[model samples]
Target: MSALFPALVAGSDRPALRLGADTLTYEELAEAAGALAVRIGGAGRVAVWATPTARTAVAVVAALLADVPAIPLNPRTGERELAHILGDSAPSVVLAGAEDVLPAGLAELPRIDVETTVTSFGPVPAAFAFAGGSDASESPALIVYTSGTTGPPKGVVLSSRAIAASLDALEEAWAWTADDVLVHALPLFHVHGLVLGVLGPLRRGGSVRHLGAFSTAGVARELGAGGGTMLFGVPTMYHRIADALADDPALVRALAEARLLVSGSAALPVHDHERITAATGRTVIERYGMTETLMNTSVPLGSHPRPGSVGLPLRGVELRLVEEDGTEMRAYDGESVGEIQVRGPNLFSAYLNRPDATAAAFDGDWFRTGDVAVREPDGYVRIVGRKATDLIKSGGYKIGAGEIENALLDHPAVREAAVTGAPDPDLGERIVAWVVPADAEKPPTAEELADHVAGLLAPHKRPRTVHFLRALPRNDMGKLLKKALPEALHG
Candidate 1:
């Protein structure tokens, strides 16, 4: 059995994690995780009250050290989703920080309060725990919950082998090393914020400084003041940074001096990309992945990343676009869009307690990503949108909502935009555009916007209906709440 955190377990005394004012060295983290691991040993599965705190990281590490699967419960999860997850995973114990006040649904679960301080060091005794119970590589490590359009959230069962493989591939892609200091204000729940933001640093023997809550000032202070090297953020955060860059010299300098800036979860508008690079002279690279698959492709470090593309597949990942009838599309043309299918070791094992759902998720060894994209002749993948939500079936033609959204965002009067297909009597579905106006006094007219789209894309891709909103509803990750928009329109 080998250790996942080889540096921490081997008693390297360098700084490992810093959340707000609290910092833990590798030895201190090892002691804290090792101590908690012994207490939580033998629990089949555990739940963590995932907050942006040092205790949250410790709890997750401790669970890994004990070879127990952990479910990260977002602290702000609503009662219905929370209850559904608790009933689904049936965790043997729920671990939270001393100050965490869980919701009513978590009251019935067995509780364990995690302490953030530890002094004992000098090598972890739990190194053997990394590969135990005879399952070693395939043993379940994390059960991350993901939402669907129809039902409650499903648990994505990520094994130790998958997580390790993903991180290792990213390590090579990003040129990540122990000398790098990662900084972010990402939550401890999702894969980008937690697995990549937190655990990725730990695995490479690097340091991660969590801001607890995101603020442009805090980011500038940390990054500009020589406190960090690499930075990870979503499009929302980067948008704010791009907005503030003209006036905030600290943030501008921070971007200019940073080793790398990565964006994920949702697509960053090409307009914002131009704004950031214009101000800081550094392009923010993007990557593509999902809860079911940890990471598939990334704009590798030291490369001139494309503004709108998600770049080539990482090492050991095989990606291909397939037609509607499951026929493989081999042409390297940049126009023909198809559903993306992937085969890699970085994929999650199964959905917890749902064999039928798990069976439907795969086509033999290839997991259908459900995301539609066009591949360039150079093999770079540029995602158009999701097949379920973003693919618009118009009159005799197929369109991608992401392209229209990007076009709408390009308009000077439009501040934000989302595109969806609504039911149409004449056509199978009509293109509907939801936009937030940059100037409410003189918002762009539907005809003007339709012409604008027609000028950019084909005439058929123009929106039939345009709805102006005060603001677009978005998740924490900056993903548009597409399903809720229609229900919200009628309300």
Candidate 2:
């Protein structure tokens, strides 16, 4: 609180947040937060579901000041999921915006109005005044949910210390400054957006240009208009931005003003990397991380990028690639494959309400990130596959889903692809590929995909069946939800 107080006071003059239609400076944002904090009189989680805006930012700031856990749910979540999250979190007060955007079931809870447009409510008393009593490096400040392999949402708790460490690491690695204005288009519900998009810039005393959501053309305009200095997005957004910038050479030049273009949440395929560089003349710095740990490794900002590699571990992070049986691989020969294990200050405290699962996730303080990757001799890490779903064992042969997915994505007709294992009698599990075509009206058939892969991939790795979908099912973070793919294909 002491650390945040000065920021609220010092940043009072600077632009703190920008939503689609509303904007707030740090001082006003803080005052609004303090008013709302008085309304939330007790300790309980607060779930926010409206669209990302300056209002939501104000609500979050208020929650933080109150020391209440703020849960940001996907604005598009259905009633069932929203109910589940709200019931689980048990928020003491439900603060919502206009009637059009509030979730249906929320009217049942005790409510408060923190809308900036209305000046009806007087400034609430500053509760629990802090005189250097609380610091930013306290307990877990945020809880973000990520869909587990089991199809249920598991809450990952992130400490303020963890968030600060990550931002510090990012600043050291990326060289972010107060002059750098970030393009904040990603959802605030996810860790990438909360840690990287919001907290990273705020702690630096820099500014962010927030979009309600991402639109390639809108982002291009923002870049063309020089709204910010850097761009951070998931691989999916980068793919769209690359396509949008293809014909508009002037827009491409405008993007050159950005110091870095970051890609995360999923592996950035080599072809996409090549396409993005060709379009913007900027290397998309691929980074490796997960919801459990804020950030593990990133491609350097100071050196030439090696396509398909998530670079060295950031400062204070210890990374080791260990075999499935838990033996550390010494050779950083860049050829050995192992599960990526991370130990760092940024690691999550634990998954919420899953003690056994939490116990299974760690090796002392080193959390096991179920990604299969190889470390190069030069210290670069290239993710080859996933341990649970990406590796398919067929006829005693091991095949990687990433290898097959990469091959499918390279095909001109394929826009997105996800490969998973399907039950087979003879083979333990046969490879199945679900693809979203570049042009929705004309999708490639099973036979066409089989023929395309027969030459590029080995017989074992070739997908046994090909399924076409309008689009791949992805989580809020743009990661392909393989568990949902099977249901999407059949139904």
Candidate 3:
């Protein structure tokens, strides 16, 4: 309705999006998407095979233009997850990019090709007016499914208003404007790359250059040649960049020249942070949010970074750290850990088709984020871990897996590390460290690693059980697959 990207549909001919050889001007985008909107009109929901391409953008924007809820399907999703999502959302039509080869799970749906370069009949309507009211209960813009780490992925509903509110809040937070050309090779399915990276720029009338695949070379080539100002990545991407920094002067120059380097999806190890900062004298800002909430807090621009904090809350977000017993933790003494609950326009409306799940996610006005963090007295939030996985209770001491993982990463012998809690008869839960050694033939022993951790953190927080591995299992987003590991040790 009134909230449809004004600058985008107003026929501003700026290059709105680019992916390799494909570049679409806002004028051309409106023309292509304007026509697609017509075909998609009256559809309840449209499923998009989300691949990093111009057609993916066009499909999503067109759904917005038509006032239809768009569901983005992860290109890497397994058959089970894909089936569950498709079954739950029940989209009327599934749209795939011209470049996309539809998977067997998607074959059951009525198919539509999301062509980037296509035809338009005439000038697009200035606004998209939804049938019930623009801001009615039925007006869901995007139905994004959760990663379902615990169970089946639930579709999280986000309204156009929420999206606009978040993007506007970010505009003020990061000083994001049309003048800033953004760069990233992040997957188009999630909140980081799509909601913020793609739509945020479109809202500000800026251009986005999506690196088809992430490489330090692609990042270097783009930013080095004045392609983009801001860059976004997950921790793994940044780690790769840090690993190559010594030999890659171009990457160093590009990162240094960029206005901002933002990391999310998981905590970027502090070791990587120091390495990158040491090489380029630029700090990568970390932001915190979830599938339910689009963006909550980010390390504010121009602030002296406090190495391991996600920084202050964004403009409209109201954040609070909640105790395990559901008591509100007003202020942090730095040692008190609590689950994060955020309230704001940035939050999602509900999980589609699951009223029980939706109800459980909320605590009155605020949504329970399930992430554990200790807020600094000055308001900076340092996330310890997720409540379900990373928080470990051992010998009456609560520990975060992240801090231990970071400490292990700093060791020359350790290449990759993941920490979790396993059942123990005496201690209730014992600290377990799964590690990949830098030199497989000469792997560090449990005694050495245990002492190493003891030297850095509290003696009580040291790993009780150390296991060596070839590699730590990770999701597509580079988050450690905590559940993929053994739940408990068998004697």
TM-score of each: 0.97, 0.89, 0.95
lDDT of 3 at 192: 83
Question: Candidate 3 clashing pairs?
Answer: none
lDDT of 2: 0.74
For model 3, the run of ten residues with the poorest summed lDDT? 129-138
Deviating ranges (above 4 Å) for candidate 1: 120-122, 126-136
Model 1 earns a TM-score of 0.97
lDDT of 3: 0.85
Per-residue lDDT of 354-473 in model 1, one digit per residue for the tens? 999989888889999999998889999989899999988889777888889999899989999999998999999999999889998899999999999999988999999999887888
- Against the true structure, candidate 2 reaches a TM-score of 0.89
lDDT of 3 by residue, 1-491 (tens): 45446666567778888987789988888777777888998999999988888888888888888888999989999888888998999999998865678889888789888776766455466555233114333469899988888789999999877888788888887899888889999888998888887888888889899998899899998888856899989999999999999999999999999998999988888888999999999989998887789989989988886667899999989999887888998876776788999998888989999999999998898899989998888989998889998898888887887788878877889988889898998888998999889999999999999999989877987899998887777877788887776532221
lDDT of each: 0.87, 0.74, 0.85
- Clash totals, every prediction: 0, 0, 0
